[model samples]
Target: MKFRKATKKDVQAIVEMIADDALGKTRENFQTPLPKAYYNAFENINNDNNQELIIVENENAEIIGTLQLSFIQYLTYKGGIRAQIEAVRIKRDKRGTGLGTKMFEWAIKRAKERSAHVLQLTTDKKRPEAIVFYEKLGFVASHEGMKMHFS
Candidate 1:
């Protein structure tokens, strides 16, 4: 297994995995010749030094997982850098194979390498299993998260 920064060619695979879930079915517009918005977002993320779009490949070099990490600089924590993980997705066939745990462990190590003071992530309350998995990995539900989505 190998974890590396994603390139433009990897977007389709990333989106495929991300859109393969119940919640994703509602929010993601995954299709052949994907919408330009996806590419735009990828370009923005790729150009940002604080952002990392990661892809995981198996021994055969097939993309099986993806996640985005954002380094946020804020005054809160006395000017600290918080590494936020989001959009984690593993191919349906690869779920429940311990790859998720290893991917997260790699993310934690990557955060430390980037000199982040803390690592954080938010999963939808509807994903109970994900919450449990995160908890098992030593994450605590310390604060209530609220979001306002715009149409």
Candidate 2:
């Protein structure tokens, strides 16, 4: 598998994988010629050095997974950098192929390469299997996460 930063052309494949999940289907409007907002957001991320919208491709160069990794700098931990992973999704037919694990390994190495002090992520509680998968990656539930949606 090849891991690389996503180009504008990869947006549709990335969005498709995201919307394949139950929760994502509700919030993501994935369709033919996807909403312009998705491309706009991708543009913003592409311009930011600290943000990476990643894509994983197979031997045929077909997109098989996607994720967004953000490097956040803050005052806490003495000006530490934190790597946050979000919006992870593997193509429906590509799961269980070790692609997911390989992606994280890449992300972890990337965080270290960037000198990030910690790597973090937040997964919806409704996805129990996801929680377990994350645990297997050595992440601990050390803090309670809270969120408020305007909608």
Candidate 3:
């Protein structure tokens, strides 16, 4: 598998992978004539130096996994920077093949290279398996996370 920063052209494939899962099928709108919001968001992420949308592809050049990393410089923790991992998704067919582990490993490496003091991510509580996977990767449930959606 190969990993690279995502381009605008990769947005569709990434969205499709995201929508393939049960939860995503309920939330993502991957219908005929894709939504402009996806492209708009992609452009926004691509323009931000602190944010990265990554794509992982197989030898066949098919995009099979994706994730986003955002580096935030904050005043807390002795003015340390934190790397936030988000939108981690892998194609359903590719889930059990060690690709997810590799992806997290890569993210951790990148975060350390960026001099981030911490790497963190929030997974939906509904995905118990994902929580276990993250714990295996050395993440802890240290704090409660709450969000209020406005849409």
Candidate 4:
């Protein structure tokens, strides 16, 4: 497998992978006509120097996974910078194959190279398995995370 920065052409595959999941089915729309919002968001991410949308492909050049990493400059934590990882999705068939682990490893390395003092992510509480998976990767449930959806 090879990991690379995602291009506009990869967005469709990434959206499909995202929509393949249970929760995503309720929140994501990856159908005919697709959504302009996805492309709009992709463009914003692509143009930002502090953010990256990554794509993972196999030997046949089929996209198998994707994730986004963002570096945030902050005044707290001794003026440290932090890396926030999100939108991690692997093709259903690619799960349990250490691909997610490999993705995290790559994210960590990239975060360190960017001089980030911390790496963080928030997973849905409904995904118990994901919590375990992240715990195994050295992430701790140190604080409660909350969000409010305007929609």
What would the per-residue lDDT of candidate 4 be over residues 9-64, giving only the tens digit for each residue? 88889999989978999999999667999999999999999999999998999899
- The worst-scoring run of ten residues by lDDT in candidate 1 lies at 72-81
Collision pairs in model 1: none
Model 4 pairs in collision: none
Clashes of each: 0, 0, 0, 0
Residue-level lDDT of model 1, residues 1-151, one tens digit each, is 9999999999999899989999998899999999999999999999999999999999999998999999999898888899999999999999999999999999999999998988899999899999999999999999999999898
**Residue 65 alpha-carbon offset, candidate 2, angstroms:** 0.8
Decoy 3 TM-score against native:
0.97
Which stretch of 10 consecutive residues in model 2 shows the poorest summed lDDT? Answer: 93-102
> What C-alpha lDDT does candidate 3 achieve relative to the native structure?
0.94
**What local lDDT score does residue 18 receive in model 3, on the 0 to 100 scale?**
86
In the range 13-131, model 2's lDDT, one tens digit per residue, is 98999999999999999999899999999999999999999999889998999999999999999999999999999999989988889999999999999999999999999999999
TM-score of each: 0.98, 0.98, 0.97, 0.97
What overall lDDT goes with each candidate model? Answer: 0.95, 0.94, 0.94, 0.94
